[model samples]
Target: MSKIGVEQSLTNVQDALRAKGYDIVELKQESDAQNVDCCVVTGLDSNVLGEQTTSIKGSVIEANGLTADEVCQQVEQKLRH
Candidate 1:
């Protein structure tokens, strides 16, 4: 079971990830990124999060302009270990 943390604003991403069986977690200021398998965000250079986005130890995925399906495909590829 891959644990995935997602930005709170991306409801479509969250639902898509959930449908794919990935555990979805809401991103918050104090959330522990080390505990998750991956962290999904709109972008690493997001003005909303600033420079604090890279705190996660696991793979960090930028949603960018990709659709939820595209995001899911990326995650699935990254999660293969």
Candidate 2:
């Protein structure tokens, strides 16, 4: 499971990800000056969780108001190794 906090309108994005079999642990709404918004999604591998490892962690920051595709692409590029 992962913690995913997002703004109001990005529910579609969240839903889409969940449909793809992601473990969503949490979600929250946040405000921003520009329509562009961001959400932080954190994921941990099973081994890390089982071992209670604090060193292994991952995060993705998804933004909106800019093109959703672009935001997602950027997030993917940044987060994926």
Q: Best candidate per TM-score, number?
A: 1
Native-vs-model 2 lDDT? Answer: 0.40
In candidate 1, stretches whose alpha carbon ends up further than 4 angstroms from where it belongs are 44-54
lDDT for each residue of candidate 2 in 30-55, tens digit (9 for 90 to 100) = 22211222243323322222233323
Model 2, position 15: C-alpha lDDT score: 62
Q: After superposition, how far is residue 19 of candidate 1 from its true place, in Å?
A: 0.5
Report clashes for each candidate as comma-separated counts: 0, 0
lDDT of each: 0.80, 0.40
Best by lDDT: 1
Instruction: Kindly list the per-residue Cα lDDT of model 1 for residues 1-81, writing each as its tens digit.
Output: 889988888899999999988899887643545578888888844643444554665787899899999999989988884
- Which TM-score value belongs to model 2? 0.38
- Candidate 2 Cα outliers beyond 4 Å, as residue runs: 1-4, 29-57, 66-75
Candidate 2 local Cα displacement, residue 63, angstroms: 1.8
lDDT of 2 at 45: 26
Locate the minimum summed-lDDT window of 10 residues in model 1: 45-54
Q: Candidate 2 at residue 17, lDDT? A: 44
